[model samples]
Target: MSRVTILVYKGFQVLDATGPAAAFEIAGHFGAPYSIRLASLEGGRVASSSGIAVETVPLAEALQCELLLIPGADNPLRAARQKELLTAIADAARSGRRVASVCSGAFILAAAGLLEGRRAATHWAAVEALKRLHPRTVVDAESIFVEDRGVWTSAGVVAGIDLALALIGRDHGDELARKVAQKMVVYHRRPGTQPQHSALLDMVTPDNRFAPLLAWARARLSEPLSVERLAKEAALSVRQFTRAFTQATGVAPAKAIERLRVEAARAAIEAGADSLEEVARRTGFGNGDRMRRAFVRITGQPPLVARTGARREPGMRG
Candidate 1:
């Protein structure tokens, strides 16, 4: 069995730790050989930025484990503890254990000297800092995440969730990961090649009451649902709704709709839709031609290849 440890610190981001934890948990349900425990430099409860407290085991207890996960916290100014945390990550990496980080946790790894001369990534805001601090680390600010050697790094917030799903896929299989993602309602399997710079969801803005509107549009993807209809459901003027939607979700309303339609088409095709035209009609793409272009744009592959259930060959790094 693989033992995994998550390193927590003061004022740590809660989602970063919990999202991957949930992934590993679901991964384990598929008979994945993984066991997870939360660890800290010292064993105790650490406070999160959201006021929720998390208890953890000691780092000393996790040293012999197969994987170590480091989560970034809100308090990056805690230089001393950050330094100590970096040293531990470096030590674990040098010892041949798999090491991973969520968001700004890449900074801690860089501080420990493990990221030198290696490709890495972090949250967009911290990408410049990572590059400046570790001159040898090739920082890709737009990647949703990166896997270098045994060390993996994810971009801001929910990208960590994608990294975990990908890792689960790597350890077990794509089918198992797909099951876990379905259960978690993640909807999309944003690959490492996906751009992290684009905002796709509006969960951060509590005031944007667009979930129902989005769901309504999602159901009628096979219809001529236009921006005018979507804005009307939100009860706002077209210009106002478009601006607010873009501000909250990070993508233009039209692009978001196209993404939803493409995702729906892929699901339909995977479920054995009679033909590409049928899949497109069911997904609101109107025709196979549009669906084909959207599929290539979003997934870097044609609809036929995706519908054929072509299994992705894992990249072996020995």
Candidate 2:
């Protein structure tokens, strides 16, 4: 069995640590070979960002392993500065075992000099921060996970499960990985190459400046949604509205509108709604072919593939 030691720290994101831990446990339950342990620098009770506490061994007790995972914390930037923690991670990296990180935990790895000149991934929201903080690291916000050299980093939350699945696939095989994912009720095991961003999440900005316009546009998707029309709704001229929308949301009005449409179409498809052409029309895609094109461009898959996979999933859909 591969001894898997996951590092924990105060303020750690509970899901970041526990989600991958659950995946490994489920994989082991299905007869995969992984002996998992949790360790922190000081050892004992670790407070998570979610207000829960978990016990951990001292870093000395769990220094070396076949794999060492560092899960992200709510304040990873702050956590990464701890000299003892960085030293422990550096020692683990030097032990010649595979080292990986989840979410903003990549910041820890980078601080330990483990991710220099390597392609890495982290929470999409933290991509800019990671890049700005670690110029030597190549950050890919578009990816669910990335592996370079012997180090792996996964983008936020549930992506850590995908990273664990990848580790299972690496140790065993794809079939075993799929089985473990199924047992965890994760349904589809999204590949590392899958995009980190969800169009729906990207479109649903909090305190959105164009929230009113977006809501209005969503209700009238099939209606002509020209930039001029959107500007009028926002009480601005087209140029002003375009600039403001792009600055606030990092997406232009047209792209944001398309994302909203895709979200609607995807919901319909997942619900087993029949008639692709009809779905497209109702979702403002004009036609099935156009919808297919949009899905391919935005989601890296055709609507048929996504819908079929969603229907065939045995448990929670990815």
Candidate 3:
């Protein structure tokens, strides 16, 4: 039985912390290996961005946690309180718990010196701020979340939900994680290397300039999608297309294509592809070797491991 402690501080981004907490509760319903507890640096109640108050137990009381989650907040400029938060995080780390962060929660982990010489990810808007605070940490703005060793860090806001699902998958298995995700209506799972934001728009608007292009690419996940082809389709020069694509999507075209293909492959695999080569070819990866490389690059695993160790149960054929 694993135990989890979620640390909430003042002015915390409510969704960043609560989203994952809620998802974990769904996992709990399936008898997953977790006992959830919410904690705070200061004992008693903690306030959220939306003026809602949530109960918080003392951090010290959560002594036996297998995982400790630190949530980000709107008021990251609270430098004084940051020290206290960092101290608490360090204590949690010393207790052998896998400490993780949501959004600017990476800031807390960095302050605790847990992210030193480690690769982490955070909200794209805070990339510069995180860099200035902790120069030694490699902050990848592109990723939705990162799990290096035992320290996990996620992108801003709702990306925390995805991070928690990944943890569920890691601790228990893919089947439970997928069930939790399904229950929560998280139709897709973003790999750690996938971009934090969507490829269609910088924000969540249906009127984005690249909406059509995004739809086009998504509709044809089984086709070859090279930079040149995408550029041509967008009627722009390669450099221009790359810059515009990144600006609009928060990710490069090539990266987006890889993500789409991987997602398609995962769906196909979960639907019971006969072999790696079949999954690869069906997802436009051409062959098992290419699929293996892409799997390693995107998911930090080989083809076989990703298939068997996926977070979803193998379903009926697609």
TM-score of each: 0.71, 0.70, 0.70
Highest lDDT: which candidate? Answer: 2
Give candidate 3's error at residue 288 in angstroms: 10
Error of 1 at 179 (Å): 3.4
lDDT of 3 by residue, 1-318 (tens): 778888887788888878988888888799974678888776699888788888988877885788898888876657325676678778878767788889888887888889999999999999998999789999898877887777899998888987898888777776787799889988544556555555335432587777788778878777888999899999999999999878887888888788777767765664446787877887788998887788788778776664453334221112
Give the least accurate 10-residue stretch of model 2, judged by summed lDDT. 309-318
Off-target runs (Cα >4 Å) in candidate 2 are 204-318
Residue pairs with backbone overlap in model 2:
none
- Kindly indicate the candidate among 1 and 2 with the higher lDDT: 2
Alpha-carbon local distance difference test for all models:
0.77, 0.83, 0.77
1 or 3, which is superior by lDDT?
3
Off by over 4 Å in 1: 77-81, 197-221, 225-279, 293-318
What residue runs in model 3 are displaced by over 4 Å at the alpha carbon? 197-199, 202-318
Cα lDDT tens digits for candidate 1, 207-277: 56676677778778777878898888899999999998888777778888888887667656554457888
Prediction RMSDs, each to the true structure: 5.5, 6.3, 6.4
Ranking by TM-score: 1, 2, 3
